[model samples]
Target: MCPCGFLLPIHKGETLPSSLTVRRCDLQRFLKVIRGAGLLSRKGIPAWVSLDASSGVLRLRAANTQVEVQLQLEAADSAFEAIVDAEFLKICSGKEASSVTLSLADDEVTASWFDADVPRAARFVLRSSDSVPPAVAAPEILATNEPHLLEALREAQATTDPGASRFALACVQLRSAEGRIAATDSRQLLVQRGYQFPWAGDRLMQITPVFGAQEIDRSQDVQIGEAGNWIAVQAGPWRIAHAVEVEGRFPNVDLVIPSPSSLVSSMSVETGDARFVLERLDKLPCSDTLHEPVTVELNGSVAIRSRQEESAAAVELVLSRTQRNGNECRLQMDRRYLGRALKLGLREVGFTAGGGPCVARDAQRDYVWMGLGQENTISAADVGDRLLSEESVGG
Candidate 1:
């Protein structure tokens, strides 16, 4: 018997005819796809794996008051509808087998696996309350063949709020008029634009940053659709739907973004050097009270400095081209947040200072704007003079 009280009918020498049967390989493939869709729930409300033989599709669905994931797989054969614990069916499919047969008799559903050397089988008695979830209506098609949609979602994921206080910042917002996707966690904002999609209206949906990372094949074209309160994505054979919640408004991120003309000092650094500096800064003790601000000084060259309670460190790099507007500028910002932009692996990263927020981006449209710290406006000359005075005193 399975852990969920699924009886092994074949072990009892019963010969119940199967109403639906398919190859073991096909069933395994379906399980893998649904598992990657983030629909395999094990606790709280029971996770159900429902088979609709009438429609020739299998489904795994789980929902809470805030989130819902419904994944469907094509090519399932069954005579009647059967719903069982998702984990139980996954285990049954995991057995060594060449083919698997499913039998629906009364409220009990039997799963039997056949192999060249041995045959194994298990049966799950459905509860009276167990029923298949109603199918979601087909959503309106928004965009297709857009590769940057996933990229934008990935970048926005870095800025989404994981806590419950700011409910709206936890979702990625798609703006139809601007053709962009954006997200923010109050401290940082990431926006990706230039998506060639025929969007009819704006849509906001809550989706995990990790969604579609493992489920969708990069080579296949992708489609985005919306209906009711859900957004559906179909990439190749993989499909994912996210239920929308929390209708709160996203902050006006454009107000925080500094214009390029307003920058006092701008510099460009190799991607490798930028990543190295950020990684080294990450090792230093960070200040929780002020969010570990890393100071960048641009004069003749570039210098990155950070201090954690009296332990101070600095890294100097000559691998940059600088444009100074008759004044050396220094900007302080959160090191970790800044690192997220630098790690994007762009060939060259453009950094702008003396702005409301520090801006970093590549040649393309990808960009990240990080909040400036309280003591953000120190001049590079002032920092140099202070360091010299301190060294003289120590001497």
Candidate 2:
């Protein structure tokens, strides 16, 4: 016989030819019985969907009685349907079934397949398959968005695994509508709210998981479904098993947004905005075009610099060109964290230059506000030398 266990031998004896096949009627009847009666042991070793290959029929013994389910593979329009029984399909739907190990001790079901391995014959412990994670349930949905916002969010990496937890947890205080979606993390925040206010909710903010942001890169449906206590998220080919929402309220975020800046009337051109925080930092002072980002920009009229008297190198976000008449502003941030916000996006941008408060307005709506943050300038021999060498000196 071949290595696959097919019957192959010298043409002799009373054995039938290898070309013979099982009958159609018999195959159908066996499948019907399994579909109706057999108790599927999903956690059993050599766990097969149809009847066991070695055992001609599947058997479930209870007390003094025994029930058998017969099954065989053959051609028929409904051949596979008999295999899709309620309990069987449910088992297959789980994350992935590693070697199913049935825990039958003295002939009784006990631990999950991943758990206890019972003794077989005289010795030899079997494989584990006992711990079955609770079935996944979808989160309690707070808001829903149209396909457009979903698409744009994908471009920014919102639906992947990294972003799932963040997106799911940030469900509170959300504004659900048809335009955009936004979330934040432990460090910074975001506000991609409105069509004319494309974002939904009282404020534009988020706290999404890192995997979700990665999912955003892949444009696909992100449907959340839950049954009983299990939470499930279907994004592209990935299915996220999320825990049920714990009882609690998300923190308030509106207190953090900075005020908006008036458009400089005199300045004809200005730039500097990145898709994410890193890009924003990169464009901080490369050149004119480098500084100008159509969606968001950082332009100041005065140069602000700070260096410490003790140690630590001083850094600043200078407002290079003030053609439109504005104060110079410096925004120093951890390059990495800044990049994360850029990916989430903003509704409007504001500038804080000349030590004066800056503003960020909701361009899609009438919402506008001011923000207060702190950082000390590195004290140098004087502010003059610091100003001259700063990146904002020219534009």
Candidate 3:
């Protein structure tokens, strides 16, 4: 007898021949992984969904041409197998039942459960497949206890240009020897350091797995490995495998960043104040795209304003710290690129003035972007600078 007041039709010690009882929580957990891998929708690029249980282990697999995600759970001793539509799992996992028993037939799957002592059943058509979803077999494994691997992947992935003609620009380059992950779209670049991995190759890993990695619990150790042209990561009971770019070579990003000695001026600001400025500019009547140029005036204080030709708006914020070898500097940067850097959750942002690419650094990572030209002069009489008190902003 179960807690729902419904007895599963099995003797005290005998298991159901063809059904497996799974907790609703487990089903929801795997569904999150499926959604993270960009497979939850039935739109373009269909994902194959397969479930199998044997030897007290239950496995759920979802795969597309770009990525594959699998989740494992412990189950009672029984043999069960089924291939169903991703939507079917979505519906079954959304029910309010505490636990559901899944029974597989030749062409259908039956989900039976108890709803407040009332029995309920739903039938879903099974998908026909000659074979189950294929798995990537990687013989090599680079297991690391690195706590920030996921954080680095997410930060670098944002800089990738998915539509770039150069395929390498659409992937994140792993610098195992230097313990760094870097990505660039020719317009902007982001590099995160302080990672220790055993990978010896210079292959470019696709960014698709970064989506799947977000679904994994951060407390688990993520194991990364490469096999030929594929890269895989295992975190807790979830495993993600992705194909890598086999032919293209990632460009050397270190050449674009300016050296410390070449920096002319450096200004620092509290992250909270910077975010407030960005959010205010975003609310202006500007293009929905992040392409709008925002000017940064770096001197004793930091000032930001949108460069929309027809609108005049300005906000001057007190700098938390500053150091400069020359006069004040001003540069026009894409609003979107600056926002991406702030997403890394760094407490402070250091804007460096140089002759080359624009550079922004935090305690852990470096961000560089190109095509930063001088902005038109904005005088105090045109749009008075609203000086914000330091006590008004919270970090």
Candidate 4:
């Protein structure tokens, strides 16, 4: 066997009978995806960048006990497998060359590049090791476009708490059969529906940390599959498989969202104004006991106020419209959390405040609900009484 663990053996110091040619730009793009997968190690170890000459695939892989990321590029030629260090390949990709040629010879992998302007040729020779990376099995699941999955994941991730008491709250849950995805951090809940996938059977998959959303190429579609304890995400030439964390029983977050009929007062505001107010409020002084709470008071017009110590700030936004059953409403919630929900870029944002949770939804049905805050909670009756007292004084 060859030193690189290939079935074929090449004589000492002899050039192996396999070579592959790839454009520099394509190789750089493939490496960029691999870097995003969190696989490249800065340490000078053999990070194991592999080339399969027969299948025309170049692969870079890094894995821990729980998760594994494999990035492949189909730009190889001939029939042999060789392993080289990731740092060597990264340096070769950085050279000012239009094309890169890789060849396996004896126990070494040679990478050669020539610049169009310069007469000199730059070449790197890396000793191949016997270590071979394990093959990543492709699971039989469903595939969807990257944009749809990414959008849902981003919204869900916004509400997921990394340090939550319940493990499931830290993960983004994808229920393919139900056509919905949901996530929450106890204080807030976000659920998005209307996703169509080909796969059947009610399979519940939980993605921890939501790293796939950051790693996946937005321009490509994603192939999703679950096998045993792992969920595989194949986006373009990269495949990432993460172990499903033991979440036990996920909480019933759907119950927290108040129905439209239960709302006492509802108000609509321009998305731009809502976002601007929230951003400004985020800069105010806040404490653990008193998170900068934005109070949304619904009268004839909508007013938002936040106060800390002796400092107070308020912004009045014209309500596009409002609905009430002869009752006033006031809601206070953490301004930072509200800012994240509003930044989803919905043209118009709808807010519903009452005795139940304060719910905000966009035109796309993407809703965020904030439960009663520990420091800031006001009842609808109290709000109505205060408004009546003010009106009586004016009269």
Q: Note the Cα lDDT for every prediction shown.
A: 0.58, 0.31, 0.66, 0.55
A best-first ranking of the candidates according to their TM-score comes to: 3, 1, 4, 2
Could you tell which candidate, 1 or 2, scores higher by TM-score?
Answer: 1
Least accurate 10 contiguous residues by lDDT in model 3: 1-10
lDDT of 4 at 361: 65
lDDT of 4: 0.55
What TM-score does candidate 1 get on C-alpha atoms?
A: 0.76
lDDT of 1 by residue, 223-335 (tens): 77776677776656555666665467777777766666655556666544555555455774444556766666667766665544343343333334333333566667777
lDDT of 4 by residue, 117-196 (tens): 33222333343343544655777766665556665765676677767664567666666666677787787777777664
Off by more than 4 A, model 1:
1-16, 19-43, 54-80, 93-100, 114-120, 127-133, 140-142, 162-167, 196-199, 210-212, 278-281, 284-290, 311-327, 346-355, 362-366, 372-395
For model 3, how does the per-residue alpha-carbon lDDT over 51-72 read when each residue is reduced to its tens digit? 8899999888887656777888
Ranking by lDDT: 3, 1, 4, 2
By TM-score, who's the top model here?
3
User: How many clashes in candidate 2?
Assistant: 84
The TM-scores, one per candidate, come to 0.76, 0.39, 0.84, 0.70
Ten residues in sequence with the least summed lDDT for candidate 1: 385-394
> Which residue pairs collide, candidate 1?
none
lDDT of 4 at 250: 66
